[model samples]
Every structure is written in structure tokens, then in C-alpha cells.
Target: MFVDLLIGGIFAMSLLPLTTGYCAYSYGRSFWLWFALGVFLPIVSYFILFALILRQQLDHGQRLLTEAKAILAEAEEAERVQREER
Candidate 1:
């Protein structure tokens, strides 16, 4: 998980140049100001993104388990019916 987060943060940070460039151009700010924000935002955003992705994965796993249980129940019922007919 830590590795995944780190990888994601690195990828996220790649966009920083565009953001900082825009901020520098539009706001007429110094490189340092835009650079600081550009650096900071991705760390925060990456953490949030990682958490959201992890949450979604867990939810999907739970749903899969529920569906598997439902299918098992149906199969059991079918088997019971087969035995009754026999």
C-alpha cells in the first residue's frame, strides 16, 4: 500500500509543471510561490486519491463476496431440488 501510494504520488506530481506554469503566468507570482504550491498540492491530492481508491476496492471486494454467497445458495437449492426429483 505504501509503495502503491508512493508510485501514485510520483505520477501525480508529474503534472506539477503545468500547474505551476499556469499559476506563474496567470497570477504573476514568483517561481517559488507556484513551485511550493505545485509541490504541496500533489502530496495532499495523492493521499486523498489513494484513500479513495482503496475504499472503492474494499467496497468492490465486499460486493463480490456477497454475490458469491448468493450464487452458492442458489446452487445448493438446485442440488436440493435435484435430489427431491430423484
Candidate 2:
């Protein structure tokens, strides 16, 4: 059972190179470092790295999304004002 679990994890990680690569890149680390971790230590490495590091990158993404919404709101308001003046 234990061996099966580890094998399953390795297989799962094999399918997630892009996600692992993204995490590595987002953390300003080496892609091969994470790719090897996923390939070798699958479950533990992903949980440890992603759980700790992903939140900061996700927060950055959220901030950018918020800024984009603000910019869109400003543009829409300007459009409304221009229409009102006409």
C-alpha cells in the first residue's frame, strides 16, 4: 500500500511539469530543482513548496486583478461622463 501510494504520487507529478515549473519560476528558483523534486519526491515536495510559496504569488496575481478592475472602472466612468456631456 505504501509503495503504491508513492508510485501514484510519482505518476501524478509526472503529469504536472508545467505547474511545478510555474511554482519554481514564481519563487525565483530553478526549474530543474523543482522538476527533480516532483519527479523524485512528488507528494512531500509539492505540498511543502506550493503550500508555503504559492500564496505570495497568488496574492500578487490578485493585486494585479484588482488594479485591472480599477482601471476598467475608471475608463467606464470616463466614457459615461463623455456621453453625458453629449
Candidate 3:
């Protein structure tokens, strides 16, 4: 759980600039507005990061499935060739 929080925190930190920029653009005149956003933005940023990471993981899983299928096919071919030699 610690690792998850650390990852989320790191991701949130990375988005700090963008969050601050948006806050400035939307409510720069109000000090309280920016302050409130600064307080809540990290959690939202972390969720966005987590979603992106999840998408990447899904893509990786698909690639791994393809590779696994290819490996299985090769192994079957090798076994068939070996049987034919006997």
C-alpha cells in the first residue's frame, strides 16, 4: 500500500505545474480559489495518473498474450518435428 501511495504521490507531483497553471487561469484573482484547488488537485491528478497507468498495463497485457501464443506455437512445432524424427 505504501508503494501505491508513493506512486500516486509522485504522479500527483508531476502534474503540479499543469494544475497550478489551470488554477491560475481559472481563478488567479482569488487567493482562496487557488488555495482550494491546490488542496484538492493532487487527489484528482493521482486518479488521472492511475487511470493512464492502468491503460498502459492493459496494452502490455495484450502484447504479452500475443508473445505467449507465439511461444506456444513454436514449442508445438518443435515437439512435432522431434516426434517425426523417431
Candidate 4:
């Protein structure tokens, strides 16, 4: 029974790379990176990918915030200039 279980587990592990690669592709990440990680460390790769995706989203949000701040500053400056002219 132990040997059979081990064999089954190994078989399941071998298929992990395919699923990981597909997920990476869907997320616009590097499929090969996740695929290689899945082969060597399948469980850890999932969490790593999740963290990486979250970090990317956070960086994008930060950039948008920065842009908004700049636009608001520009608009405020323009309003001040108009007020001074009146």
C-alpha cells in the first residue's frame, strides 16, 4: 500500500508543471519560470506566484496614485494662477 501511494503521488507531481505553466500564462507571467518551479517545488511555487502577482498589482496601483497626485497638483496650480489674475 505504501509503495502504491508513493507511485501515485509521484505521478501527480509530474503533472503539476503543466497546470502551473497554464496559470502563469493566464496571468501574463513567465510560463517557463513557473513550470520549472513546479517541477522542483510545486507547492511553494503557488504561493510565490501569488505574492509576485500581488506585488505587481500593488506597484501598478502606486503608479496610478502618483499620476493622479501630479494631475491634481497641476490643476491646483492652474486654479491659483486664475485666482491671482482676477
* Most lDDT-accurate candidate: 4
Candidate 4 lDDT over 37-85, as tens digits, reads 9898888887788787677668978668767978999999999999999
Shift in Å, residue 18, candidate 4: 2.2
What TM-score should be assigned to candidate 1?
Answer: 0.33
Off by over 4 Å in 3: 1-58
Better of 3 and 4 by lDDT: 4
Total colliding residue pairs, candidate 1: 0
RMSD of 2: 8.5
Candidate 1 per-residue lDDT, tens place, 1-86, comes to 99999999878766764555454544334656545655768455444444544565579776687679789999999999999999
User: TM-score for every candidate vs. truth?
Assistant: 0.33, 0.43, 0.33, 0.50
Q: Per-prediction RMSD in angstroms? A: 17.2, 8.5, 16.3, 12.2
User: In model 2, which range of ten residues has the least summed lDDT?
Assistant: 12-21
lDDT of 3 at 35: 39
TM-score of 2: 0.43
Instruction: For each candidate in the order shown, give its overall lDDT on alpha carbons.
Output: 0.64, 0.77, 0.63, 0.84
Number of residue pairs clashing in candidate 3, backbone atoms closer than 3 angstroms, sequence gap of 3 or more or interchain: 0
Q: C-alpha displacement of 45 in model 1, angstroms? A: 32
What residue pairs clash in candidate 2, if any at all?
none
Q: Candidate 1 — which pairs collide? A: none
